[model samples]
Target: MRWEDIKRYQVIEALLLWEGKLNARQLMDYFETSRPTAQKYISEYKQLNPTGFEFVSQQRAHIANDDFTPQFIDLEFSSYHALFNTQGEHAVTSLVETLPQVHRNISPQLVRPILQAIRYQLRLDIGYISLSSPEFEDRIIQPHSLVFDGTRYHVRAFCEKNQDYRDFVLSRFSGEFAFEGEATFDEAHDTLWQTDVTLVVCPDHRLTELQKKVIAHDYQMTEQKLELKTRAALLKYLLQHLRLDIYQAAAEQQQIVIDPECRKLLAPYIN
Candidate 1:
């Protein structure tokens, strides 16, 4: 099958896995395929993985099995959010009444070169506007990976100017860039990206028992705490996104706080 067709099949599998169920009409609407084409994709998927889902006549949908496993996509929160946040007829029913969105100023011209550099392991000379500097500076970086931290896109790269690995915000980059020399660094040397840190978060102990319980339920915590594993480089952004950086806020006001033991590890990133 064509690569696009394969991707659509994977999307169907992902929708079923995350949303628990989906109908043919939803698939048709999302992929802009005809009814027969949608059915064909479903039929082919079912034939390949019989145990993945079961048809429910009452709901007129295919419900994912309890042991359903994703075939082509990683079960990442980003993937889940991307599928639901898309503006389309088959957008998944969201738990929240309204989804928050960030208006980014990223340009396709800037992103395309970064992606190409990453793919080819090349260096890029980019004009970047950093908060620390008042003016945009020309810097050479070896692009490695792209990340979306729920708000903006970031490119993790080895900066020749700083002599360290840093995240360059995609939108903050000026549209002027050129291909430099070959890349000197690889993903293996990125210590922050290679290290896995577990963030232990729990409802603030200052809150009442009832309030703590509510917070735990909202975060789907186990044993009153939630353990999230993330790259050390990305921990700072994650904490900021979850509003856990405001350590001075009252328990009731913040609702959640990081475990004292994990705070020391996150200090460098948080600061």
Candidate 2:
């Protein structure tokens, strides 16, 4: 099936799972398609998951089956919020554009089980690889949350072998996953993830006064600085996203850096 067709079909699956019902008219309004075309979307989805939904004559709609299982789309809520997931949301089809993204082929099979582990506080035995270990290394983790570090999907989990919480990239996982009963660590035990930190950003002082003013305005700064808060563990990702690395570019070109006072306080976390 074409990518566009799959996107349309996933929309049906999302509504059926989340809203508990699917009807041709509702699909018509959502996709701006005719009755027959909307029916075609439902038909195509039904073909993929035959027993996913059933018609409710009283409501004149296809009600989601109690055992409704998704054959397409990652049902994890984070998939909906990710900037690059684009599971069901179609992006601008015209002139508006964005930089090409790295395609992270994260399988729903990997995601669903991780989400289940997080929800139930269970441990998972997984085969994963990292830059240091090019081969898949068997490891056990107790995942607490799903994180999007601007580009890739990561599961923030407690690594049993490492004896610390770490972000494991979803695409790096391989082989089959096995649930390992209960997890000793959960979100509450992740001190860094539980704590919050503030970032104070300001335009480079070396820039001309006018340039500094423009930069401040661009970042919606007040009092010549932008103050923002985020999870302590996510500080590095936020810095990378804002391009605030002081050594990356010339002061004038970089435009912004964390305020010296805040930088001193946040140095340990960023490192």
The lDDT leader among the candidates is 1
TM-score per prediction, in order, is 0.73, 0.67
lDDT tens string, model 1, 214-268? 9999999999999999999999889888888677656678888998888887777
Best-matching candidate per TM-score: 1
lDDT of each: 0.84, 0.82
lDDT of 2 by residue, 1-271 (tens): 7987877777777777767888897667666679999998888778888888998899999999888877666877444344223423433112134457688968888688888999998999999999999999889999999989788888899999999999899888884789999999998999999899999999887788899999999888998899989999888888888876446457667788889999999988987
Model 2 TM-score (2 dp):
0.67
Flag clash pairs in model 1. Answer: none
RMSD of each: 4.0, 11.9
Total clashing residue pairs per candidate? 0, 0
